[model samples]
Target: MLTHLWRWTLFSYRAIWQIDIRARDPLHAARRAWDIQRDPDSPATVFDIIDEFGTTFRVDLAEDNPHLDAQPILATPPMPAWMARLLPRRFRRHRIRSRP
Candidate 1:
């Protein structure tokens, strides 16, 4: 029981962290979320991940995305759309200025 309780606590903390990381950097968070998806403790379903990407990145194509119903999706900045191919990923994430 004690071990299970401890594991649940850890999972809660990790879930919060995963949400935070996804906010700051979706790519890295995807990697981390993938890792969590493979782990036994993850409560996230495939639907949860799909929702996360669609909602967080505003890539909602489905007419029934749950997050889309709750709030309007935020538009992505124009520059970052092609910036990864032009600039390295790390630099592109930080460089929010208009193209030079």
Candidate 2:
């Protein structure tokens, strides 16, 4: 019997998204937003993303955490003992706080 190696891969997809960008004018803002989306480190995900184009992407401004309303902010693991020792006591342990 042979064992198969498991791995995860990330795929890119095209979707319409609106982003609030601060710039001198509307055109500049749109350009800035486009640059951000083009960056490799952008946080955009393809999950539930549609391939259809020319469709409007509507978002309810009133709803916070619209897609992750039920998800809780998990606490981050503490820094290693050796790493913590190099920093001040206040910065040793860090935890992510939930929005009110």
Judging by lDDT against the true structure, name the best candidate: 2
Give lDDT tens digits, candidate 2, residues 21-74.
779998999889878878887754332332122122333333554552233223
Clashing pairs in 1: none
Q: Report how far residue 62 has shifted in candidate 1, in Å.
A: 17
Candidate 2, after superposition: displacement of residue 9 in Å? Answer: 25
lDDT string, candidate 1, 12-95, tens digits: 111112343454577777888778767776654323211322222223233354453444244334353555668767777565
Cα-based RMSD of candidate 2 = 16.8
Instruction: Report the backbone clash tally of model 2.
Output: 0
The candidate 2 region of ten consecutive residues with least summed lDDT is 47-56
- The regions of model 2 sitting more than 4 angstroms off are 1-14, 46-100
CA lDDT of each candidate? 0.45, 0.47
